[model samples]
Target chain A: MKKATIRNVAELAHVSVASVSRYLNNKAKGRLSEEKAKAIEQAIKDLNYIPNLAARQMATNQSKTIAVVVSNIDDYFSTELFKGASNILRVKGYEAFLLDTNAEQQRERELIKTVSSSFFDGLLFQPLGSNIKTIQSEFIHNIPTVILDRRLATKRWPQVISNNVTASKDATKYFLKQGCDDILILSSEVKIASTRRDRYSGVCAIANPDQIHLIELDEESYNYVTIKNKIESFLLKQKVRNKKTLIFSFKERWLLAFLPMLFADGFLNSDQVLITGFSDTKLVQTILPEARLISQNPYLMGASAAEILLKSLSGEDNSKNYEPLIVPAKF
Target chain B: MKKATIRNVAELAHVSVASVSRYLNNKAKGRLSEEKAKAIEQAIKDLNYIPNLAARQMATNQSKTIAVVVSNIDDYFSTELFKGASNILRVKGYEAFLLDTNAEQQRERELIKTVSSSFFDGLLFQPLGSNIKTIQSEFIHNIPTVILDRRLATKRWPQVISNNVTASKDATKYFLKQGCDDILILSSEVKIASTRRDRYSGVCAIANPDQIHLIELDEESYNYVTIKNKIESFLLKQKVRNKKTLIFSFKERWLLAFLPMLFADGFLNSDQVLITGFSDTKLVQTILPEARLISQNPYLMGASAAEILLKSLSGEDNSKNYEPLIVPAKF
Candidate 1:
């Protein structure tokens, strides 16, 4: 099959290549007659030719692409949330630039600065646990940015996040209703971050002080072996886990390490131990079918965030009026 | 906190700012004393000052970034596959540019052309369906592109895809073992593109001719109403679904449309109507708990694709001799 080109379309339409280019460039001004314009449109249809996007973008200075800066591409929550935002953005005829922070604190802030100065029309960021301050100081400026998964503690910028406190409380309560009185919640260095802190408090909201066990893990020391040992030791110290308990997996890393131990130590025996956590991996279901888990409505949260940020870009009075949007979680 | 800068670092280390800048830029070749280099490195650590990436890229003509041209960023398969690739690429200190083609055949080809001419070190593409022949001309020019998910049927490009034929047959046998004889296989335009056709043939290997029902939807009409109508009409036409049957949702969009109808029409009564499909969504288990699904190992596939692409870029000829790499689906 012969490939179609600008020349072919121009020849078929009986117009100069320049006129055809102007029409395809969406600059269909009085450069061409109506009959010629109609003929060019018909020729393009007949040939099934699409104008090169690069040339078009360069010509118009409008690429319609948004840059998404995620702290870690491997984080299930971040990826899922991004999926939601990208869905809406793509529907709106925008492409996403999926930039990674590689789970580094400073790298995220640096990338944000780069993105702001880049050709992107807007940005969506998942700030790293330790880079919140820098992100606020250097990242979210000049361009319209919507923060996802993590919330900005201060009202310096427009942001969006899942209803962490409410959702965790609901999840904790679900475990509590299953007769779990002693719930051990895992806390990561991310506790310094607002989302983890809110989720931690949520567990305390449902369980008594003595019944709730908090195990703190350094984000830096988070490895499979170290996590497995900590979980085993925590279970050993608890001795008798009579109630269905929840562990607020500050991130997916803890959950990934904790699951194999449950079966290895006979910790998860279907009805006896109703273990629940905030997780992003679907493999959790295959590993422990009975465990109640919190699924962050990443897609909806992301979509809402994109919609919020785009509205802000259009000069809406969202800065003062927009309440912290609380998207529900799926259990 | 005052922002860290080269001036602050120079002052902290009691060194001239020019010396610090030269050291940071790696231009201190025999020009700076060993003591000066040590002092600058220490000052950099103490102040936590980092060079501007955009400035560095501009000065060195090295962006240290790779653009990923995908068909759709919102698709679970695309996102998960990217998660795998991005994880590896980031670890290697490369930023990824995620470009969504919106499954536009013209744009898919155009994006490849654009990326080839862009400032990216290499390109990773997930070709949009079967129209990959559009890119064959450009791909042969050798700009370090590793095609993924779907392979080029007419021309062999450096590509990665799942073992569609074997995986689909295995999936079909699983459905058959569940006592399902009357099976409906949902497919996309089956894009003689790569896996779709292979997967379809694999199903034929396991099931009899009349037992297999192939339903292909229009790619142009991707609306919810259009998809729902096509599915409902197909299901209503089937006469004897008396035996235990299976609905093989070969693609994500198919499953997205099919599962809802199963719930709405009360098809999920017992294990008799076994719903099985290839899914990458966590919601699959949550929404359709009883369905048997063969999850795509997108993360691993992506990681392997990156590793292979890098190896080729590093001048390794191992990839060329290797037939298209097919990562096995984790059932």
Candidate 2:
């Protein structure tokens, strides 16, 4: 049997080929009547006509799709950021393609390369690598792009990031004012991400070298046993010294992992220890009502990134001088 | 400036046009030497060549892409499901496009219509509507589809869902065994989703009509004020009867919202109320350590769904009779 064509659908629907094309391409919003659109749809269904999107995309020079690449998908921060971007992109009649790198640098690099050369009109990236030149392919410059969350070493694109330094410094100051003599900072590897490094730098600026103690864990490989051993040793030492320690977590996952163990050990209720972190979900607040959290507005960041990318794609933003847009985090 | 073509890249790299084509189409694995591939890539970059993915897709007759449409993006359940599906899809050389309906039936219908007629190789849908015939276009039949989490009225497609009836029944029996006379079920609209209705039915099978009190809220519009007022009245009635009440929540979001409020109102510690619900996150366990949760393995469900879809797409599973694969939830 011969494959059904656009002309066949047009003839069966009793409409012009242009009408069927318009409906298929999603260009018949206000141009075609509802009755005509329904007839075309019905005719296409009856004829088992599947319009080749690749062919249509070539004709229009647009896929009406945007790609959002994040480090990981199974987290509150990633999902909220994606939701914010998709909310705006969807309103603009563009589909948002969410790509997850699983927080692997190699995967992030490959995904960026693949998405850059694909048919997506624009890209919103939350990269794991701090150096863009090392991670991104040359094809990245070919697409209109906006960076989200973390800043790269080179500022080639517009960025939407949280004020990690200010928020961390402010949180540290609050801890000091509360007479927190010892600060234990639990974080992922700081060198790979600007967000982590900036946050660590902020705490160091206010806290003395002796007052700060850092525990850096590789998130990909670190398990509960490792986390428990590291944290237990730290807490034991603090207990021996009778230090009033403030446990500062740089990521929500760290807090989630540590808090339960701390509570189980009866260390959470003791006056010698306090807890705080950068958390996107109310889960932390729900678990420990007294724990102050540094909340980054990921949704707003995602929306702003999408807005900038859309403007760039539309040729409204032609300036080469790109300013980093910092969304403040609340303590 | 003139546009760079495949011939220009081939000439610059001292390679054949077929080699350039193979590299552009991502078909160069083990086929092209590392040195030759590097030269081709460098030459393409030097000449500023951008390959048209649309044309390549047409030539291959495959986009190497799958669409995973869910009700919402900013949730643990949705994200885990997507991650599970993408983990498998990515390994099989396919890109997963995540589309969010935001729990809107209209948007779900429109998205289904658009994705069905588009270039996706398969679809993994967590639908909002109960009737597939009404919400889906006839074009949906043209694609290999798999349903996740929820079941539709028609069983035309394969589904990967939790054992909602069995889990809910087990939970209900546990609640009854605790000598609880009054049971309050907090759920979203029961009629709209099979999961909710199945859970409700499971509880109804064991508990007497008078023993159960249900509060149905529209998730899209419910606020703190409404939740508080409804809970206050329910508690007041339960207090008058001196009833031992079991608060059964059908969703993790509801549990998160209600737990904080209950604790604030000084009702959490009372011996009169026991809490348990369906939760995908460890947050609930962290907050209420003693609370028994019905945990659904969304990741497993998603992985299984993808496996089925992939098998169907590869023509490895040609059987018309598809058994609904049930991933059991834990209590």
- Name the best candidate (by lDDT): 2
lDDT of 2: 0.79
User: Which ten-residue region of model 1 chain B has the weakest summed lDDT?
Assistant: B52-61
lDDT of each: 0.65, 0.79
lDDT of 1 by residue, A1-331 (tens): 3335555777788876546656766664466688888998999899876554322432243457778887655455666666677778767777666776766666666677767755566788777663455666775345667766676665645677767788888887777776765777776664557778788888778778988777776544445456556666766655564444555575654665555445434554445455677766454543444566777666677788888766765666546533566676666
**Candidate 1 lDDT over residue span B277-324, tens digit each:** 777755454345456687787778888888887776566654444467
Residue pairs in clash, model 2 = none
Question: How many collisions between residues are there in candidate 1?
Answer: 2
Report the Cα lDDT for residue A292, model 2.
86
TM-score of chain B of each: 0.77, 0.85
Candidate 2 residue-wise lDDT, B212-296, digit = tens: 8888877566465677678778887888988889999998878766775566555666778899899886667766767888988
Query: Can you list each candidate's DockQ?
Result: 0.08, 0.26
Locate the minimum summed-lDDT window of 10 residues in model 2 chain B: B52-61
